[model samples]
Target: MRLVIAKCSVDYVGRLKAHLPLAVRLLVLKADGSVLVHSDGGSYKPLNWMSPPANMRTLSPDDVDLETGVVEQWIVQSAKTDDRLIINIYEHISDSSHDLGVDPGLIKDGVEADLQRLLAAQIDLLGDGYTLIRREYFTAIGPVDILARDAKGATVAIELKRRGDIDGVEQLTRYLELLNRDPLLAPVRGIFAAQQIKPQARVLATDRGIECKTLDYDAMRGVDDSETRLF
Candidate 1:
């Protein structure tokens, strides 16, 4: 968890005031070495992308509230247009010294990395072709933290939460609807992964045909086992 505070210039301030807020910054690692900016948190905005439109940049934040100076976090999950990489930005907690009532690991950036690690383990255990997709926007329902998939070919839309209320069944469902609507993702199935789960969310998932799993050290250890399903 590294907290990087870029020096604010007049142009930067203008962009922040116009497009986002001034919170902390965070990032989510993507499959092709690209990253996603889950939340601008007012910390930083206007990130760069190296692709065909090389030097391409995006001003993070869906919109801004000039009156309150509060810019909502941006959600750019799985922005890969092809075999290229994408980068994510968000607020991050550098360490214990910066733990302002928030668990360092819970930071969107850190959580995304953990999700990547967990997914990597699962990939090792399950197989390759499965990729990590970062999701960080709060829709009409709630926030979607990450998405996992065998998406190079098939879809396995996994929504993740590092902490907090486990009443994510509805949230997951909403996201599933979004994922399903996309012609590229219509074949996707839904999976919910978190450090913990609520009884109600579990029951709802069972009733809705959604899959839920928990991340534990054992899951990581299971990687490299010959029993793994690798392509």
Candidate 2:
């Protein structure tokens, strides 16, 4: 990862035009070729970001840019779309690179892991007569959070997330794509199970023919007297 603190202005042009005025901000260039511009606030979400499969070029400031006190410019262009991001740097406060090495990815915390376990034990939460095949069912890409047989006896791949978002739907779609290729699981279906699912994610999941079920975390954990809700 490369991190740069710079007094820069950003302009994004593509489907929309947006601008971030000159200010000191953190710029992150990830190994995947993604770029994110972040302010000190807004928690972990970046103020602006360009997703991967993009190219970036550094160039000297033009005459017009120099007159505006711009010292350098970085042009990042999307590879798959018309999106483009331009960073106009007035001054670089700091630049550093870190060798993060291989990442182990996210470690499931107690609640998430426990939720998986409880759901695995109570496979019927997915549907009536659903029987668990396994938890952490191995796949070539990664483990499916839970594998089960639906009431109809079809293989069902379940992906559990603490908070379901579009990315979670994407992940489950990939798993279904791979799993359905196997002769044994050829007709595999997908279920995106989560505590709270974003409205946008629900739309995407439904469009993909994957069912979205919102789990009651407290009820699933047996801590709350309220009935576990599934939809």
Q: Give the number of the best model, judged by lDDT.
A: 2
TM-score, model 2 to reference: 0.52
TM-score of each candidate structure, all chains considered together: 0.38, 0.52
Off by over 4 Å in 2: 1-110, 227-231
lDDT of 1: 0.49
> Over the stretch 1-231, how does candidate 1's per-residue lDDT look in tens digits?
223332121111212222323444344332333433334543554343222322224444554322233222222222343222222234334422233454457434336457646665465333456665544534455555655566365666566666423456776777888767779567667777766777777777878888877665444545444446473
Off by over 4 Å in 1: 1-113, 120-129, 132-144, 163-166, 217-231
Number of the top-ranking candidate, with TM-score as the measure? 2
lDDT of 2 by residue, 1-231 (tens): 999999999999999999999899999999999999999999999988899999998877553445468888888999999999999999999999999999999975545688799899888877798998999999999999999998888999999989999999999999999998999887998999998899999999999999999888767677776744354
Error of 1 at 53 (Å): 52
